[model samples]
Every structure is written in C-alpha cells, then in structure tokens.
Target: MSKKTVELSFPKLVLIIATTVFSFTSMSNAFYLMSYAAMPWYIVAGLLFFVPYALIVSEFTGNLGQYSGGLYSWIDHSLSQKAAFLTTFLWYSSYTIWLASLFMKLWIPLSILSFGQDLTTRTASFWHIPQIYWLGLGSCILVLIVVFLINKGFFTISRFMLLGGSLIALLFVVMAVSNLILLVNHHGQLSQPMQQHILLNSPNRDYQGLLGNLGFFIFGITAFGGLDTVASLVDRVGHNKRRFPFAILIAAILITVTYLAGIFLWGASANWAAIFTNQKVSLGNAMYFLMFNLGHQLGGVLGLSSAGTLILSQIFLRLTGLVLFWAYIGLIMTIAYAPLKSIITGTPKNFWPHFLTKENKQGIASHAVLGQGLLIIGLIWLVVFSNAHAVNLYNNLTLMTNVSRSIPYLIVAIAFIQFRKQQHDYQLIAPRYANLASGLVITTILSAISFSIILPLFKAHYLESMLLLIGPMIFSIIAVILYHHFNRQIELS
Candidate 1:
C-alpha cells in the first residue's frame, strides 16, 4: 500500500472553525427565542448548558487528533463499534433535517416579503404554488451547480460563508447594542427590565421548572452545533494539533459575547411584554423595530442604515445557509453510500471500509456526492408536496439536526470520562477548569436537558414526539445487537 497525504494552511483551519460555528440556522433561532424568553437567568442557563459540552468536545478533539471517521471512529475506539454506528446514524439523521430546514429559512423570509401577512394564513390553497417553494428550489439548484463546479478543486466556500456570516452577526450586535445604549441614555432606565423579571419569575415555582428552563437554554448552547465539522476536518488544519484549541476558544468567546449582547440589546430596545405574548414577532423583526425607533431618535439615515443592515444580513445569511445545506447533504450522501458499496460491489462487509470509502484528491467523495445529490432532489420534491408551514418546518428541521448532531458530543463526553477513569491520565489541557468528575456531571446534566427539552420541542404530533425520543434509543439497542452478531460472523468466516 502507498502512503496517503493531505495538507492545509492555518487560515483555512480558522475558516473551517468559523464556518462550523455559524453554519446552523439555529443561531438565529436562538436569538429569536431569547427575545421571547428574555430572562436574565436564561443567560446563566445557556452558559451551564453549552460550556461543558464545548470543553469536553475540545478535549476529545485534542486527544483524538485526525483519527479517521471523526465521531464514528472516536466512538468505536472508546466504546463498541455499535455505539459508533449509532452516533453516525444520529449525526446523519440530524443533518438530513437540517437540509430540509435550510429550505425553510430561504422560503420563510422570501415568502414574508413577497406575500406579506397572508403567507402564513394561506395554507392549503397556496401549498401548490407558494413563493418560497419556488425560491428554495431555485436556490438549491444554484448551490448544487456551484458544488459541482468546485467538485474538482479546493473551494473557499467556508471562507466566504464565514466572512458573510460574521458580518451579519456583527451587524446584529451593533444594531442591538446601539439601540440599548440609546434607550438607557434617553430613558435613564433599561427599557424592558420588568419583562426580565417576569421570565425569571415564571420558573420560580419549582426546581424542575427552573431546570426545564435551563434545559430550554440548551437551544442556545447547541447554537454552536457545527463546531464538529471543524473538528472533523482537523487533519486539514496546519499545526492543528497545537493551534486548533486556541482557535476554538476564541470562537467560543466570540459566540458567547455576540449572543449575550444581542439578547441585552433586544430586551432594552423592545416591549418585552408584547414580545413574550406575540408569536408573530421574530428577532429580525425586533431589530427592524429597534431601527425604526432609532430612526426617530437619531435620524432617518441612521435608522435606514440599521434597517438596511438587518435586511442585508438576513439575505446574506440565508444565501450562505443555502450553500451549506447542500454541503451537508453532500456529506450525508457520502456516508450513506458507504454501506451500500460494501453490500453491492462485493467489497468485504466490515465495520470500517477505509480504502473504498476514502475521498478523492479534491476531498470529494464521488459516491457520496452522487448519493447526496439524489437525496436532495428527493427532499426538494417532498417540500414541494408538503407545502408545510415554513417556520414550523424550520423549527422541526433544526431540532432534528440538533438531536442527530449531538450524538458525537455524548460520545466524546463518555469517552473522556472513561479515559480518565481507566488511565488516570489528567495531563491533557482542557479549555475549561473542569476535572473528569465535573465534566461528567456537566455532561449528564446537558444530556438530560437535551432529552427533556429538545425532543419535546420538535415533536409536531404526540405520537411523532414520542417516537422522536424513543426512536434513536431503539436504533442504538438494535445496533448493539447487530454488531455482536456481525463480529461472530466474521470470526466464523
């Protein structure tokens, strides 16, 4: 066998991490939720929910270091092969939903602009010819063509995404912070302090209520979901084993600051009571309102600039998200085809098919890309037919992706705790001060929150909700059984 080689620069590595941090639609959703759930305590809850997971994941990546199969490999190495498969399965499932949700993000904003308020209400009669469906379909096609063009070359898609996404995030922060400063300066009191009090009071009745709210805060923590994409690409990072952690730390700090400032500004600028009561209001709309007010306070040009920034940011974010959706779908299709290739092509059926499964020279998997394209086409058809509520679809898709994407974190936490127990090796540097026990405790808390809050939130129907929770567990159980069975078969052969 010949040796294999890959090389990537430091700048590319940074780009990868930034793309991972900002790629998910949930980041915007989290901001919107904060506007509604505007309690001071929720910020604390967000910290508790996300920090442990991030630290644990960082430790895992540092320890694992470019191991093949990323999460699947890590889990297989630490636990059983079955556990790894289940992790990959969940990850794939989540991205599938994410792919669907990207369509919703594109559709939702465009529909609102084109059809106005009637878009949400014109359900059955309009499903066949909704503006978003056509727009989303067109966007998907455009993205796929770009992916095709970059098929044989190194694409700086991540860099472009990061630049655009960061600007949008920055614009959001500035608009929000500017509004907050203006409110405090004018009123000599925070605009919506009472609403903060109410959100905090709503969960005071029981510890569980507090815990539930804390769990709900996981929505914010998980906003950093795509970080693993960076971790997965660690091999491509120059000096990655040393510098990647620093990059992640910087990214995490940036994310937290942006989130906190955005929330603070949103509360100070808006009527918190009205925001909490009304489902129609969104983070984007809140920013727009703030700009309108700012215009009155400052002048039309400044107000228009704020408004323009918000609009431009949304447009940029959606377009970038649309591209990423195709990329993720492409990744999933690659994985899905691996099992099929082993079955049909008379390749040896084994747990790891590294040779046949490797990427081409351009980091593209030929089989996976083809498979992903086919699947995306199928999903586009489904979107055309279901004509589902765009916002609901977006929420459900985000939930689906989060649940699936979280499996790796769970695996990493379990592995980290186990390694510390078995080896007593406490030498590795962690981003935070948590010891193994503390890490495990935090992991358990976060897992419980994920199970309790995320599952219920996504469930559209009672039965579907139940299945959403139960289905992965069942799949995990089945995978364990099959792994042992296959091992025995291999032994006999």
Candidate 2:
C-alpha cells in the first residue's frame, strides 16, 4: 500500500469517524440517555437511526467523491435544486443555532479551568440583568480570538483539536477503567443497580406513563443524532469503496457500543439517585462530575488520605475542564467555518454572492467566517437580552438544533435512494442496502416526530416544544425569502 493509504489505515479511519461523531466530550449525552434508564429504546434508536445513517453517508461520500458540494450536491443530483436549497438551509440553520448556544456556554469550561468549577452562575450582572450579559460579552471575545486563529487555516488550528481529542479520550478511558476497578473491588455490584423495570420504563418517578416513556425514546433518538456530521470526514479514508464502508461500519458499531457501555459504566461509580439528587450535578457539568467522582473513588480504592483524595478529584476536574476548554476552541473554529463552507460549496454558485463565497490566501472563506462570527455574537446578545431567562432560551435553541439536525439526514437518505437507483455500478451500495437505509431513516424520523409532541406534556418542556415548532417555520420562511432573492439576483445579472 502507498504511504498515504497506510497512514489512513482501516483502524485509524474508524477512529477518526468515531471520534468526530462521538467525542469524549459527548458523554454529556450519556447522562441524558440514562436518565430514562431505557436501554432498549436507545439500542433500537441506534440500530434504526445511527447505523443506517452511517451506512448511507458512507455510500454517498465514498462513491460520489466527484461532487464538490457534499450534502448539497447529493441531493441536487437526486432531487431538485429547490429541494437541495431548502434542505441544506435547514441543516445549516441547526449549526447556526448551535453556534449561538455554543458561545455563551463555552465560558463554563473556561471558568472551571480557572476556578476549579463553573463560575458563570456566580457571575455578577451589569444593571438588573442576569449573569448571561457578562458571559455573553466574554464569549463574544472568545469567538473573536478563535475566529482569528481559524482564519489561519484548518491545519494551523487543528493542533488544538488533536491535543483536546487525545487528552479527553485518555481521560474517558481512565474513567471507564477506574469504574471497572471500582466494580471489581465492590464484588461486581453496580453503583446503581439495574432494575428490570427500568429496561422497559423510565426509572424517574417524576415521569411515568406512555408519554414519559415515549419522550425518553425520543430523547434517545436525539442523543444518537450527531453522527450525520461525520459524513464530511469519510473523504479522508483510504480505499474509498472498501476501507470507507468498513471504517464507517466499525465506527457505527463502536459508537453504539461505547455509548451503551458508558451508560452502564456510570453506574459502576455513580448512584444515579444520589448524583441526580444533588443540585450541583446538572446536565451541563455531569461529564466533569463523572471524572471528578471517579478520581475520588479511584483515590479511595488506591488508599489515599482525605486531602489526597480531594486533591486527586480536583485534578480530574481541572484536567477535564482544560481539555473541554480547548475542545470548544476547535469546535467553534470548525462550526464557524465548515458548515458555512459546505453550504456555500454544496449549493449552486448563484445561490450566494461572489464576495461571501470567496476564499482568501489560506483558501479560507474569510468573509463568511467573519460574517458567521458576527452573527453568533449578535445571537449571544439576543439570548442575553431576551425577555425569557437565558437558561430557558439556551435550552430552546439546543432542542431546536437537535431536531433540525435530524431533518437533513432524512432528506439525504431520500436522495441517496435516488442516487443509488440511477447508478449502473454494482460496486457501490446495492439496491437492497439503499432501500433498507431509506426504510430505516424514514421510519425512525417519522416515529420520532409523531411521538416527540408527547415529550413536553410529560417533561414540562413547553417552551422548548413551542420553539421547536416555531424554529423550523422561521427557517423555512427565511429559506424561501433567500431563494427568491437569489433567483432574482441571478436574473438581474
């Protein structure tokens, strides 16, 4: 094999896709998934949504390498350009909301790194406003700094991603092994015993019934939804037809297995009841807490002094916080540039102005990158100054973004079915595989939507649901307006 092929070997390619889609930082999702303690639904969602999503993405990206426009090109070739425009817009809209949510929340890691805990809650406000005002300003500054570094190009900034990925991956590995040691010492007892009932139902007394369980199922679906972002990384794999699919399949299996194992492993050291009962252990900080608590328990296992155990735990939190801080740097840099680039390249040239689509010396879309940063800053302040509480608004944006991200994959899966049908080559995805992928995607998404309406009723998540409904309408309206305006621009030219 060539040096490039050897470097991007089967295992390394799998690791890249797995890490990209299911990062060490993504463990926050584990807490959410286990809150229901509904492992079966999570498993079901993985099979239906995640594995198939990975398969089709592998097929499209691996087989259709000639298309420069990623997701947009796939859809445009298989479906109509109008459908491609609308679908890509919806997909990019999710990232925009994500950028908005990401900036304000990025401070939590910075605060933890500096102070050994999140300080945003303790932040003093200007005037009568909440702490979000100051945090928003800080995040805007952070965004500017990240944007400056990203403008230098991906390779220049990716060193931070490498460092953060390695550190956090090692940390989570330590976490799993430490908990395994804990389980071994405890005579193989789970920290939170797996009740037979929780397999079929939510363990939380606060939510019980059809709506509650269905809501939990929907939540599981969302938890597994981020794998769509891994499509772009497939190009980096060697032997596109052979290695790419193998890599994706392995990544898909590993992601599902790891998530399932992580959910159970949390029980090795954490009593879900005790941890969830603590006011300090909210969803945002659960990943840190996992490391924090693991360090303390492992210290106890290794026979340390009280002060020594405290010190060890503090180190874990600080290390994770530091890793997460750098991870956010890489994250913001990519989210700011990659999605915008994909939308620009994936769509028709006429869909965007030359200035916005232009690349600078680094071949970076500097204008779009800068413009995205400015929009993110504006969104930060918008959330800060909103009549709704900042926390509520953040939750709303997160919920909408998760839902929005799923829609694009469903569209792509449809397009993939079309793309496969027209293919004369048998080496690509077989007709049977394409149909199976479409069937799974359609079924999973439809059920997720139909049942998701019940989630607010059980969870008291009315605001999030309202925004989830409204967010798409707004995105569609904006897409329609922009489509018409750009068509007019093309006509005028």
Candidate 3:
C-alpha cells in the first residue's frame, strides 16, 4: 500500500508470467504422458485447449488489471460475490495438495542428482530415520523456505522465477540437442533406432488404458495454467493493457516449442512402453540412460576405456539433474506464493479473518502466507504417518491438485461468458459468441479431464480416493463456515 512500492516493468512481468506457465516438471509430466499416444496428441491439446485457455485467462487478467483480486474480483464484478468466493477458495485450497506434490517433485530430481538412481531401491540416513521419512522432512523445510520468501515480497520472488525459468529452458535445449546428437549417430540405449515411427506413430494401447492416461491430459492442461499467478501483479505490469496479452502470446509459443522439442527428444531416447512401466522414475532414468549410453559409444569411437566413458556420463547426468532441481525449485516457490496472493488479495476483507488480512512491513500477506505453509506442513506430516508408498502418494496428490485447481477455471469460464455478454465496450478482439463458446467448450473439456483423474483414483484404491476427494470438500465446507463467521464479525466490528 506504500506510494513508493516499485511496479513491474514489461520484461519482469513477462518473466513472472512466463515462469508460471513454463513448468519444467509439467513438461516432464507431458513427456511421461506421451507414452500413451503419439506426438500429435500433445499438439492437439496445446492447440485446442492450452492456446484458447491461455488467451481467455489473459483477457480476464488484462481487462481487470485495475483490480486487486485476480479472478475473485473479475468474477465478483461479472457474477455474484458468493461465486467469486467459492472460485478463489477452491483455487487457493488446491495448493495444499500441490505443495505436498511439489516436495515430491523436488525430492525426485534431487535424489537423481545425488544418488544417481531412484531412491526407492536405495536408502539415505537422516537422523537414523528411513529415507521415506526424510522425504516428508525435506518437504517441510521447503514449505518453510517458500513461506519465508513470500513474506519478503514478490519482487524478490520474481527474481527467483526468472532465474529458474531460464535454467529450465536451458535444460530442455541441452537435452534436446544431446538426444538429437545421440540419435543421429545411433549411440543411446534405445531398443530401436530413433526413427520417424517412434516419434510419430501412435502407441498400441487399448481404449481403457488410454482412458486411464486421460489423467495425464489433466496434468498437461494444468501445466499451462498459473497464468492467473500474475493476476495479483496485473497492475504491476507496465502498459499492461497492451503488453499483457502480448506476453501471454509469446509465453504460449515458447512453451509449445519447448514441450515439442523435449517430447521429441524423450520419445527418441526411450521406448514408450518402458517409459510407462517406469513412470515413477521415467525422467531421471531416460536422461541418465541416454547420457550414459551415448558416452559409452563416443568413448569407443575416441579409443577411450569404458570406465572413462561411464565417469563422463555420470558427470553429465549429475549436472543435468542438478540444473533440473534448481529450475523446479523456482517453480515450487512461485506456486507457493502466487496462488495464495491471488486468493488472499482477491477475496474481500469482510470474508477474511483479521489475521489473514494482516500485512508485513514489505506489504506482503504475512499471516496468510504463514497459514498456507502450516497447511502444507500438516499435509506433509499426514503423508508421513499414513505409511503410503511414495509413488502412490505422489500419484494421488497429483490427481487431487489437478481436480481442485480445475474447479476455479470452470468458474472463470462462466464469468468470462457473463462478463462479455454484459460489457459491450470490452477491448478483447474476439466476437462475443466466440469467447462464450470457447469458455463453455474449454470448461467442459477440463471438467471431463478432471473426472478421468478422479474415477481412476476411486477405482484403484477407495481409501486414498476418498481422502483426496473429501479433503477438498472438507476444506470448502470449513471455508464457507468461516466466511459467514468472518463476515458477521466484520459487520459487528
């Protein structure tokens, strides 16, 4: 609220939004997802779903740049205040699951970098506790780290995102080029040559199996999200009215190109079936497999010993894993900060408890950020005590995060249609019906995609599925009760 607070320039705003959109692990998820289908499936999702969805979000953000509450304000203006509260509440709550999964995401890459293999088969001594305990412990540390940074203000957070986003881009470029080199010389551990068939042909999967993989579609769809992360910073973007949409356009193009290149390299390096079978550790396995085998072949060509090549390959894989870890850490930090910012600032003060609305010296939502961190830590502990296997825990949390996050988007879609129908002078270029139809279709697609993830979780294991589903419902019910309580308290005060 200070008059002297620095606003974001065009470039910084672009980096903030870009980092939010270009999640490296999400790209890895896409690579993992592609195991069920051909490259064109990714293209189809990008074109039909991501592109339209990104533009819709951009339009919403840009049009409402003057408002503090990102989606909440937009929906409140267009629809009802109750609708805005529910949308923001759902979106905000999703991060409870997401932060838990983020710890797993970070832990996976760090394990690969340090141990040079999957930790499920290995062990790490941490205060005499098993390695699984360490996973939750480390996640608790990361949650606190994010809470600290959020209290420091988003200016500092934006720098981390910029650095992380750049490193992730470098990771894709290096991997893609390295894989291309190996494929060219026929040097990796591929079962067959890196030919057009593997790159372009559909997998021999049955319909039911493919239906199961629709969960990954939700993963991929959610990856292109976080455009709303910048909703809190809409006013910070210099010349936002013009530059906001332009930035989204550029970010969308960059993400598409990067994903396509990364997917191609991944498919070229490993078999689809193997990737599926090794889904838990597919990314690390694929990266190390390619580098190790390529180094072996190149060493033979250079008249070096096999031992020397193995050393060289290990060095490369370690460095790659390290870079990926840092890059993804940046993403986790942003996810930690942005959604909380959006919901806390977007929701009206009447609905927020006094402590939740309190700000720090840096104008950051200190108490709200701390509360979110506590929720993540509690969730992490719950995971630790439940004694679930790490892989299953990760899979269930991913589904829960996707489903929780998608509900807000459905609300936004309805808001967009309602807003466009009412506001004749809006600057968006699309025809009224075009925007309306896109909202309906995209929301429908996302809803079905969310169901695909939910159904599988229920069928595969009733307990975890109920836990995941009920977590959101429980949170939403609590939130509503609190909203009414806080509103009444505010009115009395």
Cα lDDT for residue 343, model 3?
Answer: 72
* Full ranking by lDDT: 2, 3, 1
lDDT for each residue of candidate 3 in 1-493, tens digit (9 for 90 to 100): 2111345566665666676677555555555545424356667667766777677777776677666676788789889877787777777777667777667668766776898765743566667888777777877888888789867876677677777876766766666766676566665444334566544444533322555455555555656677666555665444554567777777778777777766666655556565455545454455555544445544555566878877766766776678778877777777776667667777666457768877888778788888888987887787774655855665665555555676676677777777777654445547755575565546656666456546656468666566656655766786688678767887898
| 2 versus 3: better lDDT goes to | 2
Among all windows of 10 consecutive residues in model 1, the one with the lowest summed lDDT is 339-348
Per-prediction RMSD in angstroms?
6.6, 3.8, 4.1
Better of 1 and 2 by lDDT: 2
Residue by residue across 441-465, what tens digits does model 1's lDDT show? 3565456545554445543455445
Q: Point out where model 3 deviates above 4 Å.
A: 1-15, 28-36, 120-127, 183-216, 238-242, 271-305, 385-401, 424-426, 440-447, 450-473
The per-residue C-alpha lDDT of model 3 at residue 457 equals 68
Clash count for each candidate, listed in order shown = 1, 0, 1
lDDT by residue (tens digit), candidate 2, 329-401: 6566655655665677777666688888777676666787788889788777777767677657666766766
- What are the lDDT scores of the predictions, listed in order? 0.49, 0.70, 0.65
> Residue 160 of model 1: what lDDT?
43
lDDT of 2 at 74: 70
Weakest 10 consecutive residues of candidate 3 by summed lDDT: 199-208
Off by over 4 Å in 1: 1-19, 22-43, 109-136, 139-143, 146-154, 180-188, 194-199, 202-215, 274-279, 282-358, 386-403, 421-461, 474-493
